[model samples]
Target: MDIRWITAFLDFEPAAHERATAFWSAVTGYAVSEPRGEHAEFATLIPPNGDAYLRVQRQEEGPSRIHLDLHVDDVRRHADRAISLGATELVACDYVTLRSPGGLEFCFVTHPGESAPPMTQWDGGLASAASQLCIDVPASRWDAERDFWGGVLGVPIEYAGGSYAQTPPSADRPMHLVLQRLDDDPPTVGAHLDFETNARDDEAARHQELGATVLDTGPEWTVLRDPAGLPYCICGPDCR
Candidate 1:
């Protein structure tokens, strides 16, 4: 099973342009792209092959559109690193959750025992996994959702933690999964992306086996919803 990239969005309300830029840059160690306009919009400048980005947009209230999550090799180590870097611990459960100086929330969950490649490419270990955005669900319901995500889609829940549910990818590929309850909001539907098996016949078989109900299908993409009314879709390899 190949795991691909997962993208997330953040509503940076009660935040200023300069502060947001600096905060995200410091957190991800990536440069900030110039704003397209003056209303405080920015995109993270990532390496050409990197899988994540931080798109900061002004919000009237706060974070209505998305919550962020991440997969870490070791949650405790990175969470400590984040804290040392001036990130504050927000929620500490099975995994460690932290907020940037600008108040953006994210968490780090250790991917399980399976041996993944190291962060280097064109050589020895696989690329080290670091992301700027993740999907957050409720911590309490993570197990249920993990089962549903696995059962509905015929995919295994590869790695799990207090607030995270990960689906590992095949060797030499990327990874993606959802984070549960990084906040205190009530349970509601969310839209996300999932990768199915490569072959059309195999993907279709997995879709039916996983209980995925199709909402839209295009030559390049197929949109569907999970059992809990969440908006999730399957895409061809190029959709990344």
Candidate 2:
């Protein structure tokens, strides 16, 4: 399937919607576009350049989590193809909503001309982009889920070791996919955003000042909980 563009939706419960939106806007240095969608539950984070690909949604229930919205020339066609592969369709039509065999949620929508935006530059020569979507699948479901996404993405999923398999990043693709196998099988699958930053220490500090709680830090990445209670990571000083 030819996925022309990809958008990451950061969904939060009603109580934390506003705060989460603000935090993400500052984190990516993107302006929060005016709210749209029925009941005013949707908005896009408009960047300084390029069509917006990050969005925010106010949820009535469910924990704050990230979901991918894939843009393509033929929504229904590609969507059906995904369903034919291991994805189970949750909603049907020109725009489709479905869950992967491993249970991660995603959508197919009509494509427009959108190019990936340049990384936002912060003070002190720090640069960052919320560029990768790390899909956390339980160890038992990794094989099926990896195969499904790899087919849908029309790319090879190469194991990068340490329980990680990734589709090589392409300039034409807006979001890169990384499949991670969890040691403990949780009740459900989840995804998180990873910011590739040149100055990891400084970037972590900036995010903390914006109300993110640092949960854990390691040599490779530092995990933090956003204001809305969703965990994300400041992953590198150029390390993937």
Candidate 3:
């Protein structure tokens, strides 16, 4: 499968969509495109240049969460490939949704375009930027989850440490897919975006100004919840 593009979607409850859109736009330095879809549930964050890699979705149901979209030339072919590697189908239609063996949900969609926004540096307020999706997998499923993504994406698994493994992005795809082993089991496996920053404290403060609340902080990263209550992290300068 040719993984032509990658996008991180911010899924929010219908009631909280507007707040999520405004907060994300402020922090990422992108303008929200006009809504699309039958109920106007979908919109893209327009970067100053290049195609968008971030999108916002107003879901009628389900808790706020992040999911990845892998764009390919043949959605069925790629979906089949993903299923063969232990992904269970969730929805099958014009596009396909699959839950990985470890339980994180992702989808396969036909490539929309070829343009990818350049990796940006901290500009208006954020020191660096959101550039990677970290999938939190239970420790019991760690090895298999790593193998499944590596096989489906055709990328070598690089270890960030004993508990974290990542699939490095190619020149064409700008976002990294990371598998992180959690100490305790989560109700459901899920993913979240990570921002690499030179000034974690300053970035955290800016996020607060935009309606994000600091949930917790550690030496290397700070966990925060967006206005819609989705959790994401801001990492130290060493992150990429």
Candidate 4:
């Protein structure tokens, strides 16, 4: 798949904003961008090529349903930095997963090593530290959603479980695009994975071809409901 962007939909109460921003800033060595309106968001650049960015949004509702797979040359170094920045080192924080200051979760593995970085300053916006975002899907919809992402993103199913599905990154990296199945009625529209394609037409193409249903579409972006009726989108940084 020609996947270009990945996002982590976080469920954060408004009160955690200051601490979350400060924690993220220290981890990235860049300031966190302030929210511009009703929706909460923060971003930071990764410097040099600017091929990608990472972000976190405040979901004042409940549990986040999705997570991101971050690719780093050294998971240890990133984890250490995150700890120094006030991010708790959760159990199993090493090797595979880690949670941020605001309880935003992600996994890191050393596959598909990164190239040398260029010198640059953080622009206080999300950078592409992650290669793929994983959306949680319902068990009944596992195969359906797997097929949807496989066909829409031009990738193959990496793994499937009774309540989980794993997709591979489109970039030249080894990152798992994960999905978790829900058993009961959804309490809230929690977390969601987002993509940044080259254009809106491309997003529409996926919707048309794959069975990805449209939730909303604007001039700058488009929202879609996956097979599980989870929310997802494709938009530029400005839309964040």
- Please count the clashing residue pairs in each candidate, in the order shown: 13, 0, 0, 13
Question: What is the C-alpha local distance difference test score of each model?
Answer: 0.47, 0.87, 0.84, 0.48
Q: Rank the candidates by TM-score, best first.
A: 2, 3, 4, 1
TM-score of each: 0.39, 0.96, 0.92, 0.39
Clashing pairs in 3: none
Please report the candidate that would top TM-score against the real structure.
2
Q: Looking at model 2, which ten-residue stretch has the lowest summed lDDT?
A: 168-177
* Candidate 3: C-alpha lDDT: 0.84
Model 2 C-alpha lDDT per residue in residues 1-240, reported as the tens digit of each score: 377788889999999999999999999999999999888999999989877888999998977888999888888888888988989889977689999888889999986545678889987799998888899998888888889899888778999889899987767655677889999998768999888899888999999999999999999999999999999988874545
Worst 10 contiguous positions by lDDT, candidate 4: 116-125
Model 1 per-residue lDDT tens digits across residues 2-46 = 112223444455444445445434423456666664554645434
Worst 10 residues of 3 by lDDT: 118-127
Error of 2 at 72 (Å): 0.9
Q: Is candidate 2 or candidate 4 better by lDDT?
A: 2
Model 1 stretches with alpha carbons more than 4 Å out: 1-4, 14-17, 37-42, 48-52, 63-129, 132-136, 151-154, 159-164, 170-175, 178-240
* Candidate 3 residue-wise lDDT, 1-240, digit = tens: 268888999999988999899999988888899899999999999887677889999998978888889988888988998999999999999899999988888999985546656645565644466778888888778788889988888787788786888777565555767888899876667898998777889888888887899999998889999889889999986665
List ranges where model 4 is wrong by over 4 Å: 9-11, 27-30, 34-42, 45-50, 59-132, 160-164, 172-176, 180-240
The TM-score measured for candidate 2 stands at 0.96
Model 2 accuracy (lDDT, Cα): 0.87
In terms of lDDT, which candidate is stronger, 3 or 4? 3
Error of 3 at 75 (Å): 1.1
